[model samples]
Target: MVRNHSEDRTESIILPDGKIDLFLFLDDGVNFEIFIGGICNKPIVKHPFPKSVMFAISFYPMAAEYVFKRSFSDFLNKKIILPPGYMGFYREDMQNFEGFYRKACVTMQRIVTDPIDTRKVKLFDLINRSKGETKVEAIASEIGWSSREINRYFRKWLGITLKTYIDIIKFCNSLKQVKSGHFYPELSYADQSHFIRTVKKFSGTRPTVLGKNENDRFIQLTTLSDD
Candidate 1:
């Protein structure tokens, strides 16, 4: 179930999963995510947080955007005081949670970590799409700007350069097909090796840990963080 209200907060329920939920802040690029790890359910008092969030259960690689966008990190770092409900991602907005508890929590997590506004998705989408095509500079030119300007803009908002984003996208594109049985009947060993190498050069980890979907995979909150 998906719902968007006048408040610009958008949320929905995807197929149930034990460990994850992706929530998007609609009309805004800001994403709030909630990750359910382990079984710790003890209520946490609202507190500040500061630190890049770990991408998932596995820690083979780390992302600055993943951890830094978290407002919880700010709270933890004493950057600000959060109301009781806004401590960690899990602790925020529990009272108003009408349903989909897990998903709701995930949304809250994204709330803390939203890096760019909603409109920025287009830029990312384009960059991701470019993975299957030509050089980054050429892609930039086709998109309207010189490679330098594009890279500069991307870095200003994404914290990583456009080159890194492209790497992440291309890597994920290759890994996704492989992981989804795309290779079951067709991909050659050479094909697999190339994909792994490409992904490793950018992510320092392969599909197992840093696969594209491994982050906030749902359309609502999916993003390709820098390598």
Candidate 2:
């Protein structure tokens, strides 16, 4: 959840964080628009109109597939507009963030009736537990699943390979350290150069510039908390 309170229009560079997001945009707190931000491997620049309030919910890979009941392959690197009342949400729910959050929770719970695959559940648990530092082969061994099968599932559901998804997770983990002015590699990168290169590959900027984050241009950096 996030909102832009600035009276003047502002630009924000959003870095990939390996999650699909559903965004609700209220221009001048009256007109409404909704967009789904698909998983991407690069940075995206956004310009929100003044007095616009934005709310978004990030979905896990498994929940995204089951709740939405569709493949996200076509949504990669794209922001697709959703039709009105796409998910049982209406103008009344958008009146307040609190109501919207409750409504969204109920909608998601009501829709997700299918049983989840245990292997995929374990796969995600291992990835989260390792913070994306574990190799695919190691994860496969730990979860008792084949590396080929894992990659096949990733490609089929998320439109990316296992290695790419792992890289994105690693990059996201580095964001907190970078936000606190720690530019050196700390998340199992080969070295400082490898860390910088990976950050640039995903964020389109070097570590120093991202650390400086002039004018709070990077949305994720500005929102991070040192907890």
Candidate 3:
């Protein structure tokens, strides 16, 4: 959940984190909008209205594909507005975050009428468990799926290559360290240069600049919690 308590609009930098998000934007307890944000390869600058609240649910690729049965390929780096009452969600759900979350869970369970592939589950689990540091071929071999098929499924459902997705995962996992002023590579990155390049590629800035944040402009860094 994100809320802007100030009287003026705020700018936020949203970095890629390999998750699709559904957002409910409520303005001053009156008007509202629903939108879905897809996986982005780079940072996005968002301007939210002042004195508004945003309720959001983040979904992994598997959930988006199996549970929601929706393809986000067309929404890369973009957000699409969802109609009112879409998927049984209504303005009334915005009364509070906890109630909204409970209702969303129930709705998701009801939407899953078909069995999800176990292999796909293992594939995603491995990537997350490894913090996207493992080799793609190794993940495919362990999951009993071919690399080609895995990549195809990723592109079809998530709108990106498997390799790119893994990189995003690695970058996301490194954020905590980066936020603490550790600019050096802590994951599977080869060296400082490689790490810097990846950080710049996704964030459009070097590690030092990102860590400084400079007025708490980076939403991910500002809101990150230790896990």
Candidate 4:
């Protein structure tokens, strides 16, 4: 979860990070609104409330299906208002950060009692293990499914093409290296030019600018701490 105390802002670009987010907006320490965010294939410009507190839960790709109990394609590149009672007991503790987190975990644990899709789980593991360089055909072969079938599953569950998801994973890995002040040429891209282009495509900024961005720091910190 992430808590942001906004002062004043007009618009900002939200870069793709290959995950779904659920946001709970609090205004004057009261529950104001709730939204469910989906996978973003490209950078998006958003205008948020100038002065408000925001708490967001960034769900991993594999956990989204269990948490929402729906296909991600329904919310691709969009934010939908959560239905009333969807948060269960968590709604009562929205004002307390720690209490809210505990309640959220309980809600998730209860909902995720159902079995997960093993093929999708394995596909995510394959991408992470290969650092997003795994071949699509290889995944299909291992999962005993045709490439077309695998692509369909990816589109429905991830809200993006398989290739785009791979690119996002690769970009995230490369970003970690960049933030740590170490770029290994052989591990990430074909060349420095390729790296710059890929970063700009997803993040709408050059590597240097991205490295210095506070939003990027928040995303990295929250993502790492989530586990």
What ranges in model 2 sit over 4 Å off? none
Quantify all predictions' global Cα lDDT against the true fold.
0.37, 0.86, 0.90, 0.73
Which rank order by lDDT, best down to worst? 3, 2, 4, 1
Q: Report the C-alpha lDDT of model 3 over 1-227, residue by residue, as the tens digit.
A: 98888876557789999999888988887888998999999999997677889998898989888766778888899998989888878888888889999999898888888887999889999999999899989998898999999999988997899999999999999999999999999998999999999999988899999999986888889899967
lDDT of 3: 0.90
Across residues 30-131, which tens digit of lDDT does each residue of candidate 1 receive?
A: 334443222111112222222212122211012223433431211211222223223243433332344335654474466455464433444555654554
| Candidate 3 weakest lDDT stretch, 10 residues | 3-12
Worst 10 residues of 2 by lDDT: 1-10
Model 3 stretches astray by more than 4 angstroms: none
Residue 1's lDDT in candidate 4: 40
- Index of the highest-TM-score prediction: 3
Q: By lDDT, is 1 or 4 better?
A: 4
11, model 2: CA deviation in Å?
A: 2.0
lDDT of 2 by residue, 1-227 (tens): 56656786667889988899888888787888888888888999887677777788899888798988887887788888987688976656667888888888999989999999888898888877788898999989988989999898888888898899989999999999898899999989999999999999999999989999998888889888889
TM for every model, in the order presented, reads 0.39, 0.95, 0.96, 0.83
Clashes of 2: 0
